[model samples]
Target: MASDLRTQDIQNPVDVAEYLFRRLHEVGVRSVHGLPGDYNLVALDYIPKAGLNWVGNCNELNAGYAADGYARVKGISAIVTTFGVGELSAVNAIAGAYSEYVPIVHIVGYPSTASQKNGMLLHHTLGNGDFNVFSKMSKEISCAVSLLNDQHEAATLIDNAIRECWLHSRPVYISLPSDMVQKKVDGDRLKTPLDLSFPKNDPEKEDYVVDVILKYLHAAQNPVVLVDACAIRHRALDETHEFIVKSGIPTFVAPMGKGAVNETLPNYGGVYAGDGSNKGVRERVEASDLVISIGAIKSDFNTAGFTYRISQLNTIDLHSYGTKVRYSEYPGVRMNGVLKKVTAKLGQLNVEKGPKPNNDIPDEEVKSPEPTITQAWFWPRLGQWLEKNDVVITETGTANFGIWETRFPADVTAISQVLWGSIGYATGSCQGAALAAKELGIKRTILFTGDGSFQLTAQEVSTMLRNKLNPIIFIICNKGYTIERYIHGWEDSYNDVQEWKYKELPYAFGAEKDSVLTYRVSTKKEVEELFLDREFASGDTQKLRFVELVMAWDDAPVALKSTAAAAAKTNAEN
Candidate 1:
């Protein structure tokens, strides 16, 4: 009474690729950004079949940036590339993701085991024929690395990498060898139901630290909460809003941590770092008696290059690793379990409303804004233009400014690969974002990018045309790398870029002439008219429009001077 059954088998490479692809889909990764190469042919073949969209980019760098952007909106994203050259090209974007703490999974294809054993200098082989070059590079970017050495390990490793990314809020690398992909494994052996839970602050020492913080807050006449990137990465947005509301403390978000709370909140103090920050933000921060920095890094950028005064006694630094009070006798406490414990204790105590600081500038002064092309001007204007339900994807350069400047409305959503300041990220990301938006029934998608960065992935314009997606792309044509110019003195040859007829790109990419539209403006008047026009829709073959604004390359955003000043002040203080 033995039963015989029909057995069906898939190629090893296809199986491995499909397994990983399905796993990604289950975890909410709908689109993958990448540059296809010979080494990754198997994965490429399986991508479309797995029901995941493959966003092809002009280069690996752009692909990485696009993935980073998608992650900013969706909380996590992935990038795929070939062995050596492809991985190396993506390093800049990956490093940016690391810096900003975006969750991106990088999948790199490698040479077969035979090639490694035979010591062939195959295509993309780094003289050693070892894939560790990518492993080491990824490690340098502070990302966790895993290799699919065995077929059985592929699913587990892929799951591990994704989990690690969610936990660490950083990029993770997975190297897939060519031959191992298609091998079969017990379907039950695959990881079951991946968890997205983040590591929390430790509870054991929470009572003591919470007591100390509460004591300081009660005694202080003025207190403030400084929100930073870690808060956003930890998905503590709601918790932060509740904490601020309960405490009745004014709040300031780090430049990289903007949109953590409603900007329209009564206690909102504005951005304290980067372009949109007010001139008096540092003074307000320094004047505070107690500063509670929740999930903030003590990095130079977030701390105004360490320029502003933070009494080691008054600072409470909270991070994933632990909690510490600077310049205090209190010992650092592990944070994994501390936040809940601290919140529980503090939740029991009655928080009293204190006198609010007069941080607002007078209407007259605020009206006569400073003459700078900073986030102050950019964000508010952009905010006004955005609809309640629209999705905003920011490229690295101007996008960083938008993070600091723009206020998130109730229905408006914002996304950027802040961790990876990869140029040319916004264009391809726009494609992914638009696709996702369409799938979700979101009508409008907008992209804000700089001219220099846009050129890096301009090829994706054709992809948009092919998909028939209508996304309004705003190219800030300053004609150079403005961020670099601010960090290091501008070198004309290095920072300057040739001006492009940006509005013409759509037509060059086979977009229907009537369906595509172009707008070039230098003044505010023209910007208002073109930005508000309702005719710019996907169906209007006459509407594949590109708007180019002529801005000065030397025009530093608002935060640049403040940052420089803060650095100088820190140097003097030190």
Candidate 2:
């Protein structure tokens, strides 16, 4: 028997665009971000009618970034763009979503079915007349692709694409031809919510695996849990935290997993990215008898260029799809189910709370009490000032590296292009994140980005201002590509960037004087004063706040300096 969640025998016909937008709404996408072009303008017409907000981005690329940011907060997001030109422009952002396990639905408005069949030379199409090229390129980045023309298949195709996106935690593509906008299709699928849940393991196999894991758990004198990025992507944080609490195990997070677990947890160890980790964390994690890693993505940067010393022999790795108990692999096991079972079984064992881990920044390392603003001083101070549920989006360079040292408060979510490492992503994404946060009743959206990276997508700030969002943006003015300078050449002129008077950008971007707040901080006292200011600290929604923090060109976070040295050596060898 089919599930009752489906509409049994009733079939309602609705416009293809209506059905698509309604389905997206049913799945929690309240807004669709994109730029309108000739090909997609008609589809954009249905957006407001279907009760979805049309977030008019300045460009296709910024739309993609906004969609990614929204997806990170809202679990799923959609972006609409025109065919060749618009889609191609958003490809880099889509690629970042893929690399970082963000689920986004990329909807492209293509030429009409008749135009494609006749190979009509459309305004947006290449003169060569192949309309299939963009979809082919999108296939490389999207988990699922659906090119729709027939209304009969549109419902299933759209559902399938969304399912794949949800199941894989990655981006999917949907190409809607202009002719199919009003075609009547079955709206039956809209009654049934998407079943993105993973299949359960065989009961016997699951029990056997759990028992074996419990045996390992029982014998270990020192067991530790390492949380990684997938813990958030897989929606396994609750189970992960339960396991950690029940077992009383020491827990550490990877660089990519910064905000997944609450840093305020008693057993919480700091980030464990090899040498980049807090002092003594590496020793405790490496010396543990068993290290259970949940959804770990050991990207070079996350692991400090593969400097992790934990042996696979003593590691039990749990992922979205499977679980590996040291040498044995359970292919069908899901981390959600596996973690639940482990937490239950953990109650049967007498687990002792380990020594209290020291995850704090030492007083001696805080700052030189110097007048100059340094990363060590700035990051920790920012950490202290951060409130609960503040969403932090960091750019790919110095800001990204600097964020690793900052401890996130409870329910604080962090968004970044860590694996993709795309420069200038945060500025555009901050706009989307701020909007999403507003929609979800999250008050504060904070962005940290470097001067060079910020220049890449600075225009998105105009979009934020237009939307009346209040995101506190901190622009680190190092005056160059600081991360690149460390990676290849420390003194090379190629890494330098042109200076911008960032404090005046809000006014230059057409923001009304009272609607925005601007500040420049060159000294530690200034930064501290800004933190203490009610308007700055509380982030008054009436005004968008922008801060330019001036630092020496060569200054960088300690983690960035160390990882860059290793990265530089690796690049030289390659």
Candidate 3:
């Protein structure tokens, strides 16, 4: 057999570090993100040999964030960190990735197995000498944890960890002992790449579920399709798209599923987050008799503080795990197969066209007194300026809510943390996303973050410059945490942020004056002129551009105000 021959071959021995890095490279990890520490210093040498670039981040936390962004854009990513302190610093970002179902392989460089067994007092470890403390902490968030002790089992464990990370679409932790870095392992394992294929659904059960959905779908006169984050995260967009388009039903997306649907489609309605949805979308969805909800995550924030008005009695929910029709459930039926079958068997439907989703950007209104930009005017105008296929990331604050009004062009990829609303996540994430975009030859990468949030992970801008990445970044210059002010802290000093000359950060981050462009725009005229500039938006020169977009401290988007008020009330409950 080929396997037996490979095991007996003369060139069977290879360093464990080389094998691990090769596996990562095979799984589409073009770059590894993390800082170098003494424990991981030697292993870093094998990265180049495996055809992987080392993306040295400013800190471990930023590294984790960047890895997450890269995974969302590039399908899978990896990060390496030193033992205790480094791993702990990156845990928050890892947890966010876990909550949102992004796949990342977190590789930790640990002290040697001998040192751990002998109870040696390592510098990164506590005096108690328990070696498993940090990894045990990660156990809560990780889908699988592989601690490589014996050289013989290392390859199997590493393969299992990476396979689980991809299949589950969640973070997995792997431990590499310092002494085992160069230990010889079977070199022939790389002869075949990882078997990363997803498990197929049971054919009989899938067909039955598909039939159940189609029955209701045909019976109802005013049926609608609702798509959500899992459709994108679980890689069911192709099937979901086919079902939506072929069925020709009125389609809508949840707030977290902003970019899943082509907004330019005639049947595509705007966001449907109960109270936070545009008025027309809300009324139409609530009135529908049958709602085909695909890959839905009805979290408090995603559903506008649990304000979803649709009844489960009239809903048929399809998920990666199973499909549900009213009171009945199909346990093993996955969405991928069911969607494909339903789309294929969809013979006819009475497609009732509703009012076309209102997408027209507003003209200059009422000759505003001073041209001060408000959230209402800014979001709509943003719709007019956006181009196709742009990677647009928004902070988990006002920008997250304001982006709802922006009508994306076809193929625009919108990134935001709705369920896992981490404040400083966007800046670091932008760094990783921009790098991934560059590798994939994506034209433009853009980011919108609050001034307060930008201060937290502003160092990632330096990483962007170091890679020669050209993402257009917009810092929403709100003086303080505007969303928090609406929630409970109207006049609290803790909500305020120190003012910084945001546009001047590129020079501080080592970008030459001519290599980058910077702007500080306040009035409507300034924003208009900046948007109209072809060179800025066209990505012709591939230069990083930073803009300080000044807005009032008290201004917040309509959705944010409603969601924040609900959050405040929920906090006060017993």
lDDT tens digits, residue span 1-574, model 3: 7645544553788888899999999888899999988888888999999999999999999998999889988988999999998999999999999999999999999999999999999899998999999999999999999999888789999999999999889999999999989987788888988998878888888888888888998898898889999888888899998888888899989988989888888788788998998758888998899999998999988998898899898999988888899989988788888999999999998777754655464554435676887888888788888888889999999999999888788888888989988889999999899988888889888999999999999999999989888999999998978888999889899899999988888999889988898888898888989999888888665799999999999998889999999999999999
The C-alpha stretches of model 3 lying farther than 4 A from their native spots are 1-11, 362-369
lDDT of 2 by residue, 328-435 (tens): 999988888888997887755434344343324447655356688877767777788899999999998778888777777788999988888888899989988999
Candidate 2 TM-score, true structure as reference:
0.96
The candidate that achieves the highest lDDT relative to the unseen native structure: 3
Candidate 2, residue 348: how far the Cα is off, in Å: 5.8
Alpha-carbon error at 351 in model 3, in Å? Answer: 1.9
Model 2 alpha-carbon drift over 4 Å, by segment: 1-11, 348-369
| TM-score of each prediction | 0.83, 0.96, 0.97
Q: After superposition, how far is residue 53 of candidate 3 from its true place, in Å?
A: 1.1
The digit string of per-residue lDDT tens for model 1 on 488-561 reads 54775787778888898888888876776777877655666765677853322224557786666766555554
lDDT of 1: 0.69
